[model samples]
Target chain A: MTGITLAVPSKGRLEELTREWFAANGLVITRPGGARSYLGAIEGLPEVTVRFFPASEIARELIRGNVDFGVTGRDLIHETSETGPQSVAIARPLGFGNADVVVAVPDAWIDVTRMHDLADVASDFRSRHGRWLRIATKYITITRQHFARFGIAEYRIVESLGATEAAPASGVADIIVDITTTGSTLTANALRVLEDGVLLQSEACLIVSRTAKFSARRRAQLDSVLSRLGAEVSL
Target chain B: MTNAAFRRTNLEALVEAQGATRATPPLLLPADPYFDLAGEEFGRRLLLTTATTGAEYCLRPDFTLPIVTDYIANGVGQPAAFSYLGPIFRQREDGPAEFDQAGIELLAQPDGDVALDQVFTFARAALDMFGVSPNIRLGGVGLFEALLAQADMPAPWRSRIRHRFGHPEALERLLKRLAVSHDTKPQKQPSRADLVTDITEQMVAAGLSLAEGRTPEEIADRYLEKQALNDAHVPAETLALLHEYLAISGPVLQSLTRIEALAASRRLMLGAPIRAIRRHLNGLGEARVTFDASFSPRLDYYTGIVFEMTGRTGDVLASGGQYDRLLERLGAQAPIAASGCSVWIDRLEAEFRQ
Candidate 1:
């Protein structure tokens, strides 16, 4: 049988956390080709193959069914797929790497403290400025869906590569939907999260791709691995 | 299956007879105006593409936006009438993305009554060309606003409620949240006394002298105002009246009478809007028109008097509404009184096929 493939974040704190979580669960990952190698194998599981990728790429691979499982942020999984839980299912949340996707505006906008209030302000901004209210965000799909839910239709999205918190001050965008853990960065930029504007509370999760084909033997292997990791996932 | 020959002869001739100049709007238009005017829900249905220059364009989903923009650009001062016949493009759930549409736009009409009469006359005339006077459904945001304005609440609450009136589910949830008494959620926030002490400490640490800045009394008053805003709730009577108002749906004339009685009972002053709507319905004569208060259309630009004509098979053949602020939002210097109706030629063809 072809070995089962699992994807994990290749870099940064996420990678370190992934290794530590797996080790704590009794599965140690080893890189035979060196730490720089993208391929690895789980100790004592000859059938389980591990591949390192960026968190975003891990999400994509899982969605495309190129990988059987992945450990990535819930936000990235949502961003990668239009229909949540149709292509992949969350096995379990890892509980760390917690961040909230939120809507924020300059604190000086004292009149705007709620999503509904933002709607009114957006319309007013359009008429006065003769353009759609610009919202800078790296999470375009999430922002669009969340704004649509609130019936906010009068804003344009400006894709942010980095430093999204500086968008409002630099006149790049009027507001932002960004990821924040401590909120110190947002507050440093003089922005405040709207009272009812937390769109998603995301954490790293172990996800199983529903589109992946699993043989009887592969399914048994996955079940054992999940049990040892205390994931309690249903394939 | 429709009489294409009749559409070419009768509908065009009827539109011309109404003194509307036939014109053609460009097939592709800047996509931002549509998203800005209609909202993202409608915008997502559009067929959009970006050019190398990074300018986004979409196939014209409907003629109204382009026609009004053209009027504002070329014919703002004079009352103008125009007619368009062509294929509009959009992603449809039930049919081809491209389909034929024909409609008339009346812009800068001086009198609202005359504008309504003219638009309704064209709607009737177009249907008469098919020799079928279908049932018409009417709704208006003005009536909803009039009823909402009578509720005694803070301006922000009133405004937020009005903004959400078009969306029934959101309005319902919002009303329920506002109705819950503040005393029930004792643990949800810090006590007011604790908050005052905390704020005083923070102000002192930040080097703001209490006397130089806001005094303790002013701060306390502001805190109370903030609490009032936070705890704002619609009175039970007002909530019931609003639900009753939204539920007033039946024959246009009967619904008007029902609204009249309801307003009288509630002591809400909706007299002017009720009278205006009653006058328009009466003006429609014996046409089979029904009214539904919660009938805002997909297009958010409709400020008043939205309507649709349904065929015998329950297929919508035409729909339109009045939009006084459309031009101003589209970049005009001031609001222009506008109203028009659109005939769904493709739907008419399907109706005939059936």
Candidate 2:
């Protein structure tokens, strides 16, 4: 309906950083209806309409082709893509909001150091404990893919909505697949990452939906935004 | 022949001749057993929904789990056989999410070979009536476990290798890792009995609630296991022999002979299981069957014989195996002697179309 629909984080430091990132690239984003408004526009690019959304919601919107482009974490892109990686393409990594999706166990369990060791623990977990090894994670799809790759199938996932690092100590899960920005929380929680357990190194990324209908004019409008941002990537 | 008519006459007759009673497991089942028993990859494909109670339920992904649950819950003390024919639901990338399948499960069957023969013969008979003679590939976990036991590694290494049986690539990776000797770091250690309390205190100090995590004892036991694993290395000669053994695949009897030769060369006794496999295959008396030493079903539960019947294009038409551990995992008080097979009518129809 519009020229190019671009979605960014609706609030907080991510929104501020996003605005600054755009401003530093010579494009000023203005909230047309003021600070509380979700609608916005670029200073000189009327062809681009800016909509603010919760970062996770932005990933879903991009996947559904409701937005031409969105800035969301790469973790969300992989987690939300039901089909596969081909459903969405990374236009650029913004380099902020950096974190890693990793598999971590309690530091006290020093014997486990790698995914191969984790597989051993998972296989013997049920017989030793009378239940499957419980992994706490919000990233179910990513975790499933990683575990399946290692041929580790004897674990169950306990969905963690908050404080995934605490899952092991909190008695809800035996291990965790979680996003960590710094190693502090894991250490404070007495957990250590497996030697080869980093499933994804993610940051804020400008992602384009391959499934989206990109008309010629819309493509041109997108090009204009990318050009002004000084971060042009073929969509 | 139409699949429905085939199911009504030939399929029903075949199952009836085996004395398998008709069974209808509920289409919607509690989701935990599937994820817990069948593993997450299989669980993820389930079309899942949540009830008001917040319990997750899924459309039956297959008849095996649900039928087994029913048998454990309501089965009489005597041995029993069950036949099921209906739609099973799963989210497929290439085809319909729901398809028709027919299968039988034999429970409390004291004889493994007898059970294997009955299920295989019945499944083959049903396929023959449909005029589809698919190539048969046979495998089993029992023989591999027997070999690993003879290999004489530590329990942790043996269990890990046994768990990774059937997945050749994973097994290869495990073997490579096993060949390397791990260096255990020098550190002051707590006694196993004290380690649980120490870890729990550490968690508490970190301001974590301990009610939901794995029991502290479980963590400590794993730590002890990790120390044990650190000190152990699978010997090179054993690894070489295993590599040779896993590569043994061909006509069933020939494969068995190769396995026997390998075991004898190492002066290791493989004992009854290898002979049992040989006798089992010889008893099959089926010309088309072959064996692959590394093959096992996708589901991790099969503990003994596993086989798949595939059409010319390699589309699996019927498959099943011995899941002796499955009943116990599903909460049986005692391990029940169990084995069975399932035939996919949809895949059979594909064969007919061809």
Candidate 3:
């Protein structure tokens, strides 16, 4: 029988929310060995197999069609690549995780308030220093596309694997594009997000892979799960 | 990493072997030039430099423009075939910077159709090697442009229609309106001639010459206290009629007939490129091509066909088009008619891994 594979975050508060959400839908999720064991299942939705993975891996797997559907963050999906027709966002505001991907500069630069200011600074930096302005961020694609819309031609991007907020003071970058739910981390780093610099306000979402094979049995199983979940949640 | 390395080496060898058969050396290009040619948004990531004389350059965003530049600079007037392989950059919302892209360019070909076919063949083969069986969907911008010409709309209105033809929402809206009969009077149906006359008179009174970059439409809008006039704000009744005509723009063969009928009705003639493109599309058998009258690429550089190949999962794995005007902007004396595609290697790799 064809079954729909559903991936969920394996651990952390996200995992707890996954179980709670499933339980609220009258489907119980359980992993016997807790931390070490990655396997989990939703009670009464036996046809739907739940594979536990990190949030990022879940997003990737959904895109690859390795899993029929998955729950992950909108930021993760956008961070992974351009969202195309192959992936459909089934449900958003899943109410567990939320964050904003933003562009931030040094707090000392009070005059810089919007993306246009950043564009101006980028151009001035390039002309005066004879080099492109450097921006550190993990969200390189979104950053590039955003800056392009403003007609800012000359700017460099340094990929930051971690601690992006520290890049400006650390001399690793001139500015940063990163995620922040609160301004505390940015303030601690002496960096402040610019006004109108929030590129994306992301939250958790239910996503389905358009490329995934959906047999009659699997589709029915998905419909059943969605119906149960829909009944449980109030619009 | 090892698997990727192996794939890269294997592809490089195969391309090199093909290059030798054509008596051309495989052109190895640095990633930076591709990024430079791609300009602002298209370029991937730029690495900052410390050397005083060194400029920050990015990983190449695309291959065609750089390859074309190489062809023009090194082998000007000579036939050259060049292939390249390297990691390109694009931001992944959740991932890293580098993505592999490899392709070839054939310059100075007598027949562009033959070259286009080869490019398609190469794309199919490349995807096949990675076990991706893609369904090819085709469309042409020229055919859409031809249909707009027949709409008998003013230039600004025609431009607006042409600009938005490829957009599904805009096209569908236009088509739906065009298909219906308009019995109601428009909220506003100012005469274009009168508007033009009023604008000219206003400009003359203001001591502004007509030649001062002021279009008749602009002057008309100023007198009417309206924003810039395009076909978009035309009376709903008139637009409905125009829409009815546009709704019939279909597949290449059917679209040709529709365009012909439209031209006869309007007493207008189709341009040469439109004719050439129709002939080309007619020859492409069962390519799943649609003639979208309103397909505009986000990148303004695209002068002709713009397409994006999406995976079954809905990810845009590859997107490219003809950019005949880009070369001129980059300082070429004559317009270079060229087309190229870039595969989102990271997305491809992700699909393969899955």
Query: For this target, which candidate reaches the highest DockQ against the unseen true structure?
Result: 2
Give the DockQ of candidate 3: 0.08
Provide TM-scores for the models: 0.75, 0.90, 0.48
Kindly list the per-residue Cα lDDT of model 1 for residues A14-81, writing each as its tens digit.
98998999998888988788768999999989899999999999888887788999899999988865
Q: Model 2's lDDT to the true fold?
A: 0.81
* Top-scoring candidate (TM-score): 2
Put down candidate 3 lDDT per residue, B1-354, tens digits, no spaces: 447666556666655653522222223345455444444454543332333555544444445656676566664555555665666554554554666676656555466666555555555556555556654444556555555565544454564355344445544554454445554543464776876776566445433345423345643443243223312345564465456555554565576567567656656576565566554554445445555444456443465555555556667665555666655545566666656565666666666676
DockQ for every model comes to 0.17, 0.52, 0.08
- Root-mean-square deviation of every model: 6.6, 3.1, 13.3
**Which is the winner by DockQ between candidate 1 and candidate 3?**
1
Q: Candidate 3: which stretches are off by over 4 Å? A: A84-86, A231-235, B1-27, B36-40, B44-354
Candidate 2 structure quality by residue, lDDT tens digits, A80-163: 755636667887888799999999987765567889878877887777667788999999999998898888888899999899
Error of 2 at B247 (Å): 2.2
Model 2 C-alpha lDDT per residue in residues B1-354, reported as the tens digit of each score: 466575557776776677777888888999988888877878888889999999999998888888788788885357888888889998876434888888889988878779888888877887876777768888858888778887866766777777888778788998887778667664565798788788778666755555544556767888877766667667778889888888888888788788888878888777577766666665456547788988986555677788888877688888887888788878887778889999988788777767
